[model samples]
Target chain A: MKLYDYVRSSAAYRVRIALNLKGLVYESVPISLLEGTQLGEDYRALNPTGLVPSLAIDDQGSGEGILGQSLAIIEYLDECYPEPALMPATPLKRARTRALALQIACDIHPLNNLRVLKYLTGELELSEEQKTTWYHHWLKQGLSPLEQQLGGDDSRYCCGDTPTLADICLVPQLYNARRFKLDLTPYARLVAIDQACNQLTEFRQAHPDQQPSHPGENLTRR
Target chain B: MKLYDYVRSSAAYRVRIALNLKGLVYESVPISLLEGTQLGEDYRALNPTGLVPSLAIDDQGSGEGILGQSLAIIEYLDECYPEPALMPATPLKRARTRALALQIACDIHPLNNLRVLKYLTGELELSEEQKTTWYHHWLKQGLSPLEQQLGGDDSRYCCGDTPTLADICLVPQLYNARRFKLDLTPYARLVAIDQACNQLTEFRQAHPDQQPSHPGENLTRR
Candidate 1:
């Protein structure tokens, strides 16, 4: 498998975590979102959506192996490699887990993604301050309710003892939140869960900073 | 099962289509998005996210049956009542189907949802024309790629002969685009698929105008 990835994309970060949890090894083909490589014709040919973290599996029968969308890719991985399950056993529990993930994936992340941010500052011509306000607004709108939902739970992860899809999605979103310097004080429960997930080798390995294409590497080497 | 729904919410509309496809009888409990009813304390208690299309099931063991997020709720219904499955059988096909669905759910619909539009006009103080531009911009960005992806497909539905989750998500999003007066000329394949899906009794029943709470009713009566 070859993963067309961008280090800073939360969606790519999600697929990385899922792959690590499933103990799968894939060659990382870095598609730099910062350099606008994903929008180039070559990447668009591979994945028409021109998105990062598209997994290309080597299908013996046919050459068509590319898959896009982080949740879809993660769910595909979980379905194929079901030992360390990323979902709950029961239908209701799975629904709950997916709901938590979707809360971040659909409701929050889409509004704050790099493309959307660019649109705000570039197309809409919002000032930098206004952009930051937009970022913080969506984070609070999403994370506040999420914090409330996960508040009373004593589970180690978002859904249960094991790290499920909810945790996979939450950690990246929290990472993005911190990048924008959003205050994390209001979401203690979510913060704690993020911390717990970060302790795991799988989650730690999937951190954006750990990726080969991360921009922070040059400064660190210096 | 009881569905906490809003007439024109694309997310809610997706679940309504899924329910109708599965032939499941769900009482529609209208939570008006236009009236700020979804953000009220009562609705928030039912769904901490305060989003519409929350399904409340009568679980035999406990009263904890409220489920949020349209895709999660639809998946739950598909699981519990699997006679006519909403997902493709194989993992790869399912992933492809989900990728198509998420393209709209995450990429397009969230950008143009009622709340996000309100934020653009209310918080960002964009002129109504700017808000419309933002809406149309995202629709083009998302739908162009989707059209390219679905261009050569000969399937009756988004995935296959049967109406899958992809179709369920697509119809509502197209409905939203049409509502915004988006020119549908660029997406002939999608428009044809939408037309094909609308011919079904299930999809027809799930139309916003068919809902008891739809604002269009009074005008029709007059």
Candidate 2:
């Protein structure tokens, strides 16, 4: 299997974590989102949305078996590889876990996505402060509700003691949030869960800095 | 089961269609989104995000088994009642089906939702034209990729012949698109699918106009 990935894409980070968690080895085919490689015809053909983090399954010598949408791909991975389940066991618990994931994936992240920010600064011609405000607006909007959903539960991860889909979705968004410099003090549970996730090798391996696109460049940035 | 629904909510409409398709009789408890009822404290307890279309299952005598997020609710319904499967059979097909559904549910709908639109007009203080542009911008951005994903497949619905999750998502989005007066000519496949879906009683009954909140107003408006 090969993952069409971008270092900075949080969605891509999700699949990377899932792959590492399941102990599946896959070649990373970097699609430089910043350099506009995703807009090229070839990548567009593979993924109509031209979004990063498309997993291509080895289809028994039938060429690349491409799949899109991080959640869908992750779910597929969970279904295909059941040894370490990404989802919970029961229906009700699964719904709760998925709802937590979707709260960020759909409601929050999409609004503050890179393409959306670009549109605000490029097409709409909003000022830099305006763009920052827009970013923080959505970040707070999403995080506040997420904090509520997680509640005061004493679970090790987002949904349970074990890492599930909700945790997969949570870690990436928190990483994005810190990148934009939003205040995380309000979301104690989320911050704690994120800290716990960071200690894990799977999540650590999938961090943006570890990606081939920008190898250990956190030093260069600082 | 009782559904906390909003008549004009695209997300709520999706759940309504799913319930109808499964022939599950659910009591429609209309939560008026336009009236700001969703923001009230009581409703917020059920859904911290203050979003409509939450399904409450009567778990015997264990109070209301509330579930939020349309996709999660629909999946729960599909899992509990497997007579008419909402997702495809195989993992790959299921991924394809979910990818198509998420294409609309996450990407398109959230950006142009009532809350987001209201934010644009209220906080941003944008003119009506600017607001409309914001709406159409996301509509085109999402739908264009969707058209490509659907590819010239002659399926009656988005995934396959029967009305799967993709079709449930497609119908509401198409309805919203028409409301905003976007040109449907560009997405021939989606338009055709929407037309086919409308012919079904499940889809027809879930239409915004058919909701109790505003009944027969389609005729009164004329």
Candidate 3:
């Protein structure tokens, strides 16, 4: 198996955490979103959407094996490798877990993705201050409600005691929020959950700074 | 089951379609997005995110049955009602179907959702023309590759012969695209799939126009 990956993409980071939690080993092919490597003909042919973290499985040499969209890919992984399931056991809890993930994935992440940011600053010609405002506005809009949802819950993670898909999604989004310097104090529960998840080796291993292609890595190796 | 819904919301429309496809009956309580009904205390108490299409399910006296997020709600319904599966049989095929759906849900729909458009025009002070341009830009960026991905596929639906989650997502997005006057010619494959899905009673009954609170409905009755 091989994953077309980018170190800093929240979507890719979600997949990396899931893989690590499942104890799965796969080759990580770095796709440089910064350099527009995802837009090249070769990557587009591999993933028509031109997105990172496409999981390519051999599947015993039968049918389409490449998958895109982080949540979908993570679900696929969970279904195939049921041990340490990323979803809760019951359907209702599963739905809640998924809803939490989608709240971040659909509502928050897309608005702040690299391409959309480029559209704002490049095509729309918004100032950097305006762009930062756009970023914080979405973070607050999404995370404020999330903070309320998680306010009273005392689960070790987002959905349950173990790291489920919700936690997989939340950690990376918090990482992005901190990178943008959004005030994290408002999301105290989320911060506590992030701190708990980071204590796990799987989550720590999936951090952007730990990836091969992160800017902090050695230039020669990268 | 009760659905907190808005007639023109793509997310609510998706849940409506899923309910219809699963042959499940639901009470549609309209939350008018235009009138800021979703922002009211009543709606937020049910769904803290202030989003439409929150499914309130009485799960045999189980806890936490209210499900938010269209995909999560649909998946819960699919799991509970397995007669007509919204996902494909195999894990890989299910991944493909979900990837197709998420391509629209995360990438296209959120960018063009009501709040984002409001942000574009109200906060950023973009002209109507600029908003339209922004809408079309994302449509092309998202749908062009989707068209190519679906180009040679002969399935009656997006993932297979029967309508899956992919088709459920596609119909509403195309509805929004046409509303924005996007050139459907560039997305011939998606347009064709949309036409095919619309032929079914399930899809047709789920239309925004068919909702109780649709603007075309008599205001007094509403």
Candidate 4:
């Protein structure tokens, strides 16, 4: 298997976490969003969306296919290899878990992604402060509801004691939230959940800093 | 079942379509987003998120519980009553349908929703033209990916001949796209899929204007 990935993309970071959690080995083929590799004709042919973290599965039995959408990829992985299940057994529980994941993945993170922010300042002409406000608005809007859900019934992980789909989505959003310097004090439950999840080797290895092409170390300005 | 819904909300429209398709008789309780009815104390008690299309199922034998998140609500409805299944049988196919749905629901519609657009122009101070551009940008970004998937499959519906999760999601989004005056020519495959699905009676009854709160007789705007 080969993962076409970008380190800073939270969606890609999610697939990386899932692969690590399952102990699956894959070759990394870097597709730098910053360097415009995603816009190249070769990459575009592979993915019409020109999105990263496209998994090229080369298993002999199943034949070849390129899978997109991080949640869909994770769900497919869970179905194809169900040892350490990312989703729970019951239908209601699965819906809740998926809903929790979507709360962050859909509601919060998409508004603040690289392309979206670039569009806001570049094409839409939003000022820098306005752009920051746009980012924080979604962060606050979604985190409040998510924190309530997590604080209500959650213990260690989002659904239960073990990490599941909700936790898979939570870690990546928190990674993005911290980068934007958004205040997360109000979401104490989420903050606590994120802190615990980060300690595990699966998550630690999949951290943005641990990526083979991490640009944060040498080039990032303080 | 009682549905707290608004006539024009795309999220609410998705739930309405699912209910009609499943042949569930749900009582209508309109909470107008335009009039700020969702923020009222009565509605907020039912849904802390203060969003509409919150379904409360009241069965004589089974107890009532509030279901939120249009996709979650639809999935739960499918689970509770499984005769006319919305999602596909196989996990892979189901993931494909859902990935297509999320491409519209998560990536496109949220960005163009009333609240977000209001924030964009009001708080972020984007001009009217910029807001229009912002709306079209996401609509184009999301629909183009969907076009490729739908074009490849060429199913009568998004997955197969029968309407599934993808159609349920697509119809509502296409409704929003049309409302925004977006150029649908770029998404020819998606437009074809939506056109075929919208011709159905289930999709017809679920149209926004047919809802309890729509202002005019015809759902189509002048």
Candidate 5:
């Protein structure tokens, strides 16, 4: 199995952590979104979405079935490798976990993704400051409600003591938040939860600076 | 079963359709989002997120337990009542089905829902045209990809001949699109699929016009 990844992509980061948590060995074939590597003809055929974290499986014995979208790929991985279940067995519990995950994946991440930001600056003609403003606006909207939902009085993770699907989502979004220097202070509880997560090796390895392309240069303070 | 709903919310409409499809009898308690009913003291205790379509089940011998997001609530229903399976059995197929459902639920609907539009108009102070532009931008971005991802050539529905979780999501979104007067010509396949769903008694009965508090009698289209 080969993963088409962009080091800085948070969605890819989530999959990396998931893979590590499951102790899965997979080859990382970096697709540089910054250098237009994803838009190359070879990559486009592999993923029509032209997005990062495309998993190409030679399960067809010819590397024909390429899966795009991080969540889909992760679920695919969970199915194929079923030991450490990313999702719970009960449907209600699974739904809760997915909802929490979607809280980040759908509600928060998609809006602030590299493509959307590019769309803002390119098509909407938002100035640099305006783009940042747009990003932070969504960050606050999504996180504010989230804070209210899972504030200071919650469990060790989003669901409970065990790190479920929600934590997998939250850690990356927090990384993005710190990258943007959006005040993490507002979400006091979430920040605390994130602090606990950052201490672990799985999340540590998935940090953007740890990636191959992050270049031994100025790294965003986490 | 009791459903906390707004007659006009498309998310609520989806749950209602699912319930009706399952032939489950549920009592409707309207939370008028337009009139700030959801923001009141009573509703706040039920859903901290202040979102509608919270379901309460009394099988646990208490009315206080059940509450949360539409997808979560729908999954609980699917688990509790397993006769007509909304999701397929295989893990890969289920992930594909869910990815399709969430392409609408997480990506498209959340972006254009009442609150987001209001934020665009009221807070961002975008013009009506700009709001529509924001609305259609995401709709087109998400839907075009979804239309492509949908292997409609092989099946009448989004996934196959059976109306899986994807169809439950797609039918309501198309209803929203037609209401928004967005051009449907670009998505003949999606329209054809929705038409197939519309022919079903379950989907037809779940239409907004068929609901109890439908405003079609009092207020005309904007």
Candidate 6:
């Protein structure tokens, strides 16, 4: 297996954590979003959306194909290798877990994504202050509800005692939130989950700082 | 089953199509997003994110247990009633199906969502023209790539001959594109898939105009 990844991308970070949790060994092929390499013709052929974290599976000893979307990729990994399941066995539990994941992946992440921010600052000509405000506004809209969803549970992870899809989505979003300097004190359960996840080798190894594309500087901050 | 829905919500529309496809009888409890009904305290308790298209399952003779997120709801329905599968049988194909769905559900729709549009025009005070531009910009970013992904496939639907999660996503987006007056000539395959999907009774019944909240008016324009 091979993963086309970008260091700072939250979507790519999700796939990285899933891979680590499944104990799958794969080569990381960095596709730098900052360098405009993802927009290149060659990379676009592999992934039409020109996004990071496309997993190329080598099933049948011959390459099957590449898959995109972080949640889809994570679910694929879970289905293909089911030992330590990333989703619950029951239908309703699975739905709840996926709902939590989608709350972050769909509602939250896209609003403040890199391209959206670029458009705000570049095309919209938003000042740095306005851009920061935009980022914070969307981040809070997403995190407040997410904080509530994860609050009532007394589990070790976001959905349960073990890490599920919700936790996979949460760690990366929190990582991005910290980078944007969003106040983390209000989201107690999410913060606790982040702390718990980072304690594990799977989550620790997949940190953005540990990626090949990291610039030898710590991107994560308290 | 009872579905908390809004007529124009792409997320809700996806679940409606999934339910119709599965031949499940569900009562539509209209949650009028435009009327600010989703912001109510009671609805928020049922759905922490305060989003539409929450499927409340009435299993075990109990009145309800709410399930949120369209993909999660569809997956739950697929799991509980598996005759007409919304996802593919194999992992790789399922991954492909989900990737297409997420590309729209996560990347495309959210950026141009009703709430996002309101935020743009209300909070940011963007002009109507600027808001339209923002909507078109994100829509194009998503659809152009999706067209490329679907172009090579000769499948009747987005993933294959059978209607899958991708088809469910495509129909609503195309419906939305028409509403926004986006030039649809470019995405022939997608347009064709939308046409094919609408021909089925399942997709026909799930049309936004057929929903209870639709004010007996055609929202889509050529």
Q: lDDT per model, in order?
A: 0.89, 0.86, 0.90, 0.81, 0.76, 0.88
> How good is the docking of model 1, by CAPRI class?
high
Task: List model 6 lDDT by residue over B106-157, tens digit each.
Answer: 8999999989888888877889999889999989999999999999878899
- The segments of candidate 6 whose C-alpha lies over 4 angstroms from its true place after superposition are A213-222, B60-63, B213-222
lDDT of 2: 0.86
DockQ of each: 0.86, 0.78, 0.90, 0.51, 0.44, 0.87
lDDT for each residue of candidate 5 in A1-222, tens digit (9 for 90 to 100): 777777778888888887877787778888877787887878876665566877767553333467766776777778778867777876656766766677788667877888778866776676889778878987887787778778736687777776666788888899898788898888988887887777778778877777764453225422
Better model by DockQ: candidate 2 vs candidate 4 = 2
Give me the overall lDDT of model 5.
Answer: 0.76
In candidate 3, what are the lDDT values of residues A2-52, reduced to their tens digit?
889888889999999999999999898888887899999999988988988
Name the better of 1 and 4 by TM-score. Answer: 1
Candidate 6: share of reference interface contacts reproduced: 0.92
Cα lDDT tens digits for candidate 4, B1-222:
888888878888889889999998888888877678988889877776777768886533545667677887888778878978998887667767777777777788778888888887787777889888888888888888778767876778888988987899898888888888988888888888888988899998998777644555245542
lDDT of 2 by residue, A129-220 (tens): 98889889988888898888786688889988889999999999999888888989999999999999999999999998887555543332
| Residue B44 shift from truth in candidate 4, angstroms | 3.2
Provide the interface RMSD of candidate 1 in angstroms, 1 decimal place: 0.9
In what order do the candidates fall by DockQ, top score first?
Answer: 3, 6, 1, 2, 4, 5
TM-score of every candidate relative to the true structure: 0.96, 0.95, 0.96, 0.92, 0.89, 0.96
User: lDDT tens digits, residues B1-222, model 3?
Assistant: 999988878999999999999999888888888889999999999999999889999875595467899999999999989979899998888988999999999999999999999999999999999999999999888998899999877888888789999999999999888888888987878988999999999999999778755555423221
Query: For model 6, which pairs clash?
Result: none
**Isolated chain B TM-score per model:** 0.94, 0.93, 0.95, 0.93, 0.93, 0.94
